[model samples]
Target chain A: MDSLLTLLPMLVKMAIVVGVLLLLPLPLTWMERKIAAHIQQRPGPMRVGWHGLLQPLADALKLLTKEDHIPADADRRLFAMAPVVALVPPFLVFTAIPFGTPVQLFGQEVTLMISDMNVGLLFILAVSGIGVFGTILAGWSSNSKYAVLGSLRSIAQMISYEIPMGFSVIGVVMLAQSMNLSQIVAAQEGLWNIVLQPIGFFVFFVAGLAEAQRIPFDLPEAEGDLGAGYHTEYSGIRFSLFMLAEYLVVVMLAALNVLLFFGGWNGAPPFVPEPVWFLLKVGFFVWVFMWFRFTFPRYRYDQLMTIGWKVLLPLSLLNILVSGLWML
Target chain B: MEQAFFLLLAAVAVTAALLVVLARNPIHSALALVACLVQIAALYVLLGAPFLAVIQIFVYVGAVMVLFLFVIMMLDVRKEAQVRFLRGPLLPGLVVLAVLAGEMIALLLHSTRLHAVMGPGQPVLEQPSVADLSLLLFQEYLLPFEVASVILLVALIGAVVLAREDGASAAKAARKEPRGAAR
Candidate 1:
């Protein structure tokens, strides 16, 4: 009973974090529309609420009300299971991240983030890696040629990029000498990881983009060629879940980048709270992601493979070597 | 509670392992194998080797199993037949299986008699950290580690050589693809 009482507040905090994470998509969707529009010299979403701020609400309603569809010959179990699989890993990864230092709540200290896992970054990687199964299974079970091809591309893409992602982060882990996210952040007290490991930062950013299947790396759903790709058969909220999963992963990876490269909750001292600083940095990273999405052209499939395997993989290995020397 | 969790994980692992052999669809079998691997990882966690559990997930589920599933899906192996489990090697297979099972049962039954001592709720072995594991690997197990890598390298090369088609065969294979045929 005492343990239950102790866990009650922690559970509440977890609920709040989840609620906040769920709602984050709304503002992010708004921000994405606004940025993409400005990038293309167009006035974006300005009709829903002030400057179309409530646009995501309308979009969500539209999706929620839409008819869900499963094909006649599709694998029913797997087809229904794919989107949920896509949705889960990001939530787990998000909860593992430590957003800021602990805050005083009801005379007790509560950490801004959900959990400070000892192997937080590793836990993030493993769970997020499983998320690739979503796209793979989505394509395979859809019983569509295009979807299968897309899944092939997706599988190949992830396998190619995931290595670089792991190697890239190895530099940060080596410098911090810990797999704990909070410890990594704390280690950056004097200087951020980006300064110490510029190549690592660049590699991580690019790999992070690919990891979440952002534009330029979004070959799996190359609509022009593959007709919406793996999600060609999905409709309604299930489709929305895939998109939500992508965006959530993007946000999480961006947040991770900030924590690993930029100093987490580190900014010029002001009256603002720590979480606020963390959020602003994360928001900036998300904006940069959107900006890159708008600006960059998608790479050819072969080029993507070559870049991941030949360019980034070797570069990350070199970064590790250099970082090891620096650490020594 | 921990025992309950362990039992649940073990049950799932055992069932999934069975399904890996019993399932008709190759994809289903691959997925079942993945499920079994994941459940084993969870069981590892419940056993207090959280580091090993994470590595098990990372290396096995993340890389190996995904590639397994990818290959199975790519080959489009729709419906595999009820592969004869025993067929001609029934006696030998059963002997091996019985031996394996007996070994496992003996190990589990006599677990406490092995080296490591556990207290009331302690891990069977000390829950070593990543640093400790790495230190042991580089220090005492350094030669074995290097030998393992060399063996892995040879196996990788062998796999590539086996998988790669000769020029004529490559051309023939390429000619079978829709896009390649068009070109």
Candidate 2:
């Protein structure tokens, strides 16, 4: 009876988290279009609802009703499974993220997260990286040259950028002296780690942009070269699922950036609720992500690789060395 | 309950690992590896080594294996080509497998005799904190860490050198291009 009581709040929290995470992509998708429209000097979906609030819902309904199409020569099983594979990891990663302090409900202190693994940072990274496999598999199974090329390009970009991204976080890990995201955030109680680790933050931010497959680093999905990257063969809800995964990744990266650099739930005096502060920080990063998409041009393949390997990797290494010496 | 969870996790880990080896396509293999990694992480949780589990997933599954998948995809090594390995080198592989199994069995038997005090009722083995791991890494293991860094640096340099197109070859190719251009 006691165990069941303890488990109930956990179930509730998990439901809430999943519910919120699933919903966030809707607004984010709308935001992407609206932002792009505004950037291009257009009104952007004002008709759907008040300021096009229901546009994403409308889009969803349309996609849901659309005919599911599969290529004749595609590997049927892998093709069917690819979207599920892509979608699960991002959802799984949300489990470890601590939203707020534990709340007492029915005589049990229920954590506001699904799971609080010690290696929260690593878990996020690992799960997110696994998402790439789905993309690669989708491309391979599609038996389309363009899809394969796009997938290859994306995988290469992700792998190249991840080194610098990992290294960038090493400085934060060094300073926080822990790999636990919650602990790392807690360590920045007084001062945010971003102030201390600006270079690390910068590298991570850039690497994240590449990882999210946003513009400038969005060579994989460049419409000019590769038609819609790994999802070229996908249509209907499967296509939506891929897009949802991408946006969720954007959110995840933003949240992670906030957690790592911006002192996740930490805020000024008067103590804004932790979740609000966390959301605000995440929102800020997401906006910045949108801004980057608007601002930068797609990088050429060679140039992208050069920036990742030549510029970001060496800079991150230097940042680590400098931080290590400083700490010593 | 905990024991049941551990057994389930172990089953998942083993199955995923087997799938990683058995998968025909490289992409499928990579996906299986990811499953194996996540299951291993679950096992880590069951063992109360949450930190190690997370790091295992993060470093090995996330970064390193992603690179492996990326390379495999880029190379586009055919699934049929990869299968040929099963046909060759059977004896050496069996010997290696036997040696590994023997070592693991020996280690398990040895550990059973040494009854170290663990946290009461729980399999909590007083594992070092992240701070302790970092301290040990940067202090005691500093030389080895530095050596590994140097090795990685050398590999990076070698890769760049190998990938670069030679100036003389480019010049020769440019010279040959004019013959076709004149027509």
**CA lDDT of each prediction against the hidden true structure:** 0.87, 0.83
Tens digit of lDDT per residue, candidate 2, span B38-144?
Answer: 88878877676777776787677766777777777667567453673356668988899899999988876676544344324654457557677778889999999
lDDT of 2 by residue, A49-164 (tens): 99999999999999999999999988889899989888988898898888766667677677767877666777787678777877877887888888988888887887888789
TM-score for candidate 2, residues paired by index: 0.85
Candidate No. with top TM-score: 1
Model 2 stretches astray by more than 4 angstroms = A103-108, A268-271, B17-23, B74-127, B138-183
Q: TM-score for every candidate vs. truth?
A: 0.92, 0.85
Q: Which candidate is the best by lDDT?
A: 1
Q: Against the true structure, whose DockQ is highest?
A: 1
The residue pairs found clashing in candidate 2 are none
For model 2, how big is the CA root-mean-square deviation? 4.2
